[model samples]
Target: NLPFSFIFFNGASRLYRSEDFGKTFTDVSKVLKNYYIRKEFGINVGPENSKKVILTADVSKLKAGGAIFRSSDSGETFEFINLPFHPSQGMTFHPSNPSQLLAYLTGVLCCLDDVNARGNLHLQRTTDLGKSNTKLHTNIYSFGFAGQFLFCSVIHNQSLPRSILVSVDQGDTWNEAQLPPVSHEQFYSILGADNEMIFMHVDEPGNTGFGTIYTSDDRGILFSKSLERHLFVDSSGANDFTNVTSLRGVYITNVLDINNTIRSVITFDSGGEWRALKRPSNSQCDKTAKNPEQCSLHIHSTYSISQKVDVPVPPLTAPNAVGVVIAHGSVGDVISTLLPNVYVSDDGGYTWWKALNGPHYYTMLDSGGLIVALESHPDRAVQVIKYSTDEGQCWHSYNFTNETFMFVGLVSEPGAKSMNVSLWGYKQENLYKTTWLSYTIDFNELLTRDCDERDYVLWLAHSTDFGSRTDGCILGCKERYQRLAKSSVCRNGRDYELSKEQAFCQCTLADYMCDFGYYRVGNDEKCVEQSDLKDKVLEFCLKGKEEQSGSWSRCGVERIVEGQTRPQGLGLD
Candidate 1:
């Protein structure tokens, strides 16, 4: 089990560490000082040292920020690691080396910016924990580790299709990995599994609702088509198969027939072969007068004859277990009354059993074969949260007295203490005000008692830092985006404007005048004029073309010159 885990709380302004599972937490914000960790970038733990935590902070003019911090002695203390670039995203440590890190310098170009400005996006690699770094590539969409090999999906040129590149020598050199002939322009979901197996799902062109799944066992050196159909693989949430074994992987497809019933399939041999799973039967529904026989008895025979049933695509799979769960209803003239609300298949999707009788949203926990179900009813004021172990063979329900608590998600750490889960929910106190809350539950203690008799302690905390008054601001604006007062107007470009009604607004330069509290950092980008710039800082500037002269200004940074054709590594000392 994991010895310790860290959580970013209070809107990532504060960090906490828990050694005894979710029992208690100690504020480790002092180690991070005044820098607020960027929750979106994610906090990474050292592969070798669980206590060695890495987190990135937002860079501002006032604070000494925009750097990565590492805690060698857990959260007690931290040391700053020099980053070649600021505002990095997707920071990941090597699976075998804690000192190796990979991150992309993002936010270098805005959405409205030209594609040529994309050269600023650099995928950097560091093997000595930021002591030195190398620019691996540019325009990287995503990257992950498959064993000792590092894989990256990058789009070198906007006109060309994205390429899959692999680096086996700790990102020192890269080789183009062979991918399927599917359109490389579409979005791809790449996952690395155990035994050096890499799986990728390339979306088909057009809205065919089908994609091709490719598998590579040679560490992405060669890939072969595993499945080519309308396969719906549950790759989101906690069920991600990136770092897990491919034996328990499950996906959904349709049996070729006139009716084309959706079928759940499981692959245990790293997607070398797949076997269709049987649909679950409901004995309770069979005993009813309307249906006096077992549903499986009739359904299995009918499936053999008609080869059609109303089964939805993409059956939900358990996070770490060999389980496949699905829900469906009758379609067209087929009046099948024996169908249960939910069916679950364990044992690598070989057999199945009716799990639940009513509609509910299912969420599989990371451990203990646990799954939670939230009631799906628009009219219901109070909803029930159902917990089940043993692959949903039995379930216990807990009703929420607070009607405002809406289920959001479950947070569980890999290799965490078993049966320790945290439930996130959104609480709307009123129409205008909303809050995010979380409840940490220890299932081992709660499952010991009966469903009704169980009285477990729920440690409640604010998932979002609502108490913080500081709001986010953009480059050209020094006032908090939420601030109602406007001090200055834009002379060259339009001042970024935000209304009280809009939750978010984009600030773009129509002309070049800096708003109050902000000044032109270089020639283009604006920063807080009052910020303490003690060292040399890279600032975004505007370069005008000869023809467009005063008519157009290209918003770019000094590092990205106007006519530079190649990406240059940032000089960091």
Candidate 2:
């Protein structure tokens, strides 16, 4: 949430700021009185700390570049971070620290397709608020952090066949993550998830044709193939990848089989395992002759870091999301008279129930506690915005505007934490004229109260039992087990705290990740060490090293070449 009530609006010639959470507004445009606001602009604030704010926009300047205005007092005053170029992307503030920022000094773009015009980019950062800067890299494809590790994917020499360079020492030194060898045609980009886990989808030819999902729980030391031909999409050059794993580390994907039928699958243990979701028990059409049946479901697209370019990708969803998910599909073998509708699932896609009778452009609000959608009809004017606080089973409608408007998009600000929704679209004044406007719907004013007991529901994880672990458990308990949490919450749910105690899980792989080049076989408890581990695995795996601090700080390099002598304290014996 915002410490100040300042709500900033771009694209209106002048920028507006409201401190009252969009309740009221003031013209803060005078702060940047010297330049014009370009269509591409960014406004960033600290996540949960000081009142530092940054506003960057392409301004009409003498040098024909963008301007970045920084404010330490929450926009009360402003200063400039003079740069030769403006970034198309936003300033990424540190998750905990505000004074620190990660930004790129990119070159100018002549047009939308100026893919190469990013101007020999310098990925830089400023820790002392522009007093000093450090260039992290140049011409990187993308970069992100996993726990203490920093990963930057780069298309080598500005070409295909990218590599994810890892920096374990705050970018002081870098090494390439030993990902599965990929072909030139294969586009392997990282997937999004929570915790210190990495998921990558490498495109390969197969009947499913989705791509192979490779994962690294040990933070880029090595990767093992997890799910093949699963649901994966690189929304903005792979930024908005996957169904954007939700509140409980849940990943939902629609696996399109050779029959062109999509079966919904979800993974709770990262992509280590996957299970098909049962069709909504009460689905109206329940036939199995052709495609588009109850199993022929489609899901929403979620984002990790969305690029700000215009691309005809799936509808984007960022949402300070949670586990409550929604899908749209039919129950009948669609060779018949079956139509698709919205279905709701609270327990990570194990079971689902119908929510909306028709396809709708929907999103989760109130932290996955409420579901809201604009009925998806491209040719008609939208009159009502519907929402469901009792999960997706029941919904209520709110007229966002006095008259119908042609819907372009509905977006909930990432962390505003308010029911305030901004709906923008075209209001045709006549056959010859249409005006664009936005309506701010503060659901706090529309609804009577928070969800009550009738909306309270319970669901349990289907894959909580870890009977077989490759990382043999304490070596004493044989019939190891896991505590399955039957999560129950009101319409507005909260995460149930599970027992920290691994009650009965014995000799299970739950306690340990397959050590270094070792991985557990499918549903088996034995950790199978890769015979070719020397070539691409850890050079300082804890299990293989004598100096084991259980951290990567004390690490070594992998120099396992054929017919070469092993380094001291680093042999495959």
Residue-by-residue lDDT tens digits, candidate 2, 43-104 = 57776543677766555434645557787777778887665455557767755345677665
Per-model CA lDDT versus the true structure: 0.47, 0.53
lDDT, model 2, position 73: 75
Worst 10 residues of 2 by lDDT: 555-564
Query: Top lDDT: which candidate number?
Result: 2
TM-scores of all models? 0.56, 0.69
Cα RMSD (Å) per model? 24.7, 8.6
For model 2, the local distance difference test gives 0.53
**Highest-TM-score candidate:** 2
- Candidate 1: deviation at residue 342, Å? 4.2
